[model samples]
Target: IFFVSIKLTVPLAYFYILLILVRELCEKFPGSLYIPIQTYLPYLASVVSTMQKSSTFVEVWAIIEALFYICLRLHIQWLQYKDPLEASLSSAPMLELWERRQLWERIMEIETDDPVSFVTGWFFDQDLQHITRYDVLDFVAWSMFEGRNQEHLTGDELGQLHDFVDELEWKISEHLNRSDSLIPEKNTDKNEVGDNRKDNQETPITSEFTQEKNDLDLSDGISSPRRDQGDRPRNQFRFPENVDDDSPDFFTNLYENYHNWYEQTKDRLENSDFHPVQGIRNYMAEKRQQIVEKEKNAMATASNLAENAYNRLVSPGSNMDKQLMALSHATQSQLMDAWNSMVEMKERLETAKFVSSKRKVLQQQLRGYRHLLDSARAMSSAIPSNQMADLMRKITQCNEAIERVEWSARDAFVKATGYARKNILQRTEPQRYAKYSHDPLLGISTYPLMFHLLILGVTDGGLRVILRRRGFERRTMGPIAYYFHPGSSDHTEDENEELNDEDREMTPIVFCHGIGIGLLFYLPLIDEMLRLGRPIFLPEIPYVTGFRPWQSP
Candidate 1:
């Protein structure tokens, strides 16, 4: 009898568990699980009936279990097909300005032969959707042309590119607007459902009925915004007119207004006789005066605290240590304020558009900060021994801050006076072999050549193993991989031995591979150079070696 009771309870327990799981799935997916539930309701009813009647209960239970498993599998597959990007957008009213800027930067960094395919692959990898390949390609092309000042392009081409960009921007705006409209409705519905569930929890039967009604309403595309509004209190604080609190659209508009204001300010400063460098100097002078006042106040406070501590030593419950700690904190705070002021002055000097004379003035201001730092350090010795650790830390920090300011000032002066030289040996033109001028159909015609390349690659791997055995060391520097073999002379026994008159100078050979299958074809040349008793260096240019075609050399 005990075994029979346990057997009966197990099936009922499973039925209840399945019901709970289905309810959770419905809540999680919202409007997505309606069709699956409708199709399986009959099977669920039969299973419940069989459990009650005890006739063919095992067979019916197995069948229902199989159907549930199948439904779950289908649901998972459906979830995989859903566009996560669209889902995220639906949850939010609009993208933040920073997020949009980051997205634009990522799009600009795409350096590929096929922008469309490259962007498409990225979207699929990132689980994004709603952005088409053509739109991405158009944006990339327009950005590239604009960066180059539309060089080598006709006027018609430029006009067409501009039109493409305008259309793409319009489409994005429309999509965002649509999201803004739909998200509020969804949020209201969710709030109403939550409130309804809370109210129904007192009676299980009523809760079940309410759950069914909510699911039905969701499937029929209905919401209760009026009910939600009626539930809200009238005395709640509201946002100001023409303002959207924490909304991206509002922030973007604010940013544009700020930018326009900055431009006007810059233009006014440029047109006026007032020099920005002079203003910076005046600001620095005021800050220095404030720092001097703070130092004097700190010294007075410390001296007064010490005298008070001496007087309180004779009293009960004096708390002299606490008073000393407070004084130390106050002094540290003053030092921190001074350091912050110096940092701000440095930033202002760097940002000011100044000539050589103005730069010299900024340098003088920086030197003043350094002198202040020296004085602060000298004054730190007066701090109590117990508090010396924290004071010393603050002094070190101030020293670092002043050093940074001096370095930035010098860098700014160099930039203003054109003292820094640029690298002249860097390549300016694109490589001929790197150009993607060949027809894509050539890939199909050259299909058989891939086998030959694969064989060469395998042979190259084997040759590398042999080179490793022959005392050659392979290493990587950034993106370039090279093989180095210190020649026989490097391992000579006598360090101070002079060369004989008959011996000539031996120089190492540095060989770089071209646009082909890497160093596999140059083994013979390497061998010949190695026989001359000189070191051999072979740097592998993977980007031009046909294997790493996606990379830029």
Candidate 2:
């Protein structure tokens, strides 16, 4: 009873498992896979059941199972066609049928005597078994379109291959006929349906769907050929014949029209003037240069004042009075120069702002031409006529030339208007003056003032601090380096004790900044050094200073 129950339960379990597999497969795969699995699954089950019986037919069932498995494996691998989106096909069903044909041709290359031998031989080929079905079809396409070498194949192999090809073709045709009812047609007759019939009666249809050619309008002969016409052979080019007068050939006419268009474009670019905004910018730049020069002189005087004061402290009876007096006189002169430069820069900056309207119009025109040129270049590849190649080359040359002139004018206007300078001011200044403001002065719409210099004073670390007000009391000008001394304030005793014997000796760091950079940006670095209990000095830069005098242009 136990053995009889076991036999019955095993067969029942196998049936249940097979049914579950079919259900899952139906849900997971499209018809591409579902069709074959649905057709062969019942046969597979019967063979398995036959092999379980201890009869003489069990060995025969096993042989049949091996052959079915091999055929099924080969069929599954080759039937997995590429997507419709990839192939750019209107119908996926048509693509599946086409892939079926491709697989049939590939299977025909075997030289074996029987179908089982052929299947085994064909399946074991190193080059053909792996990779995608689409790739296999592509290889076949290359051999068909280009020449293929079949010298290695024997005469008997060729005969077998052709015979297999005939049989496979017949089988594929039969499968396609079977699947025909399942695959939807590319065009469905809407008039045969319910609401679609009423809609079709009221609305016009496309030429492809129209039944009556006599009632159709013939206003336009035909729409332009497909955009891929350029990919066809050179012999496919078609142009309407001109038989009236002795006009030039199609290509000659194209060349002449393009040449005239190019000349006109170049002429328009050449005719345009250098806008007046450039002059205003140049004037502003000149004034700014003067201010920068004056600031340099002032920096020199400040440095000299510090040096003179330091000399006096170091040497008691030195002839430092005369040197101090000369430095003071130079400092006053430099300050006056800076003041004059600032006033002139302000006036020129205002003048440069007036030509904003003219600049806008010029920019619009330049952009339009650039966009037109780009459109022309984009259309070049889609143009079917090979004769247009020469014309396109000429058009490209003309476009480049116009671009060069337009860009040069643009650059000049930018430089004259001090656009880059204003951008720098926006980034470096505080958020309060970050908005558009007409004012062009320190801590406002321009480079900020170095307030650190005003609060700076001498320390016990032998630093020579130059007071700007005191330096102006005399007249001379020079450069100055402000020094910071660690262990000079209330924390000095504790800092000194904390320092190791090796770190007790301090190496002074001279803080040098580049052009257009200010001391405020380096405050973080200064703070870090102070935390490390090390001494640092900052030198004043001239060109970056907020004040200056106007120079003679």
After superposing candidate 2 on the true structure, give the runs of residues whose Cα lies further than 4 Å from its correct spot: 1-53, 82-216, 222-292, 300-553
Q: Give candidate 2's error at residue 145 in angstroms.
A: 18
What are the models' TM-scores? 0.20, 0.15
Best by lDDT: 1
For residue 445, what is the lDDT in candidate 2? Answer: 21
Tens-digit per-residue lDDT, 1-553, candidate 1: 8445533543554565566556556557746774465576767544444444443555455455545445544544554554332333232333223444455445534422233344335345321133433434333443443211122123444454444343333333223323323333244576775564445332322221112222212122212232223222111111112211111122223333444565577689988856565676687789989989998888787978866876767344457667777889998799778767767645544344332234345456545544543453346344333233333334444444534444444455455445763521122221111112111212311111233356556856776897898779998986667999977754244432554433335567889888777787777888777665567888877646653432322
State the lDDT at 40 in candidate 1.
68
What TM-score quantifies how close candidate 1 is to the native fold?
Answer: 0.20
Error of 2 at 155 (Å): 42
What C-alpha lDDT values do all the predictions have?
0.46, 0.39
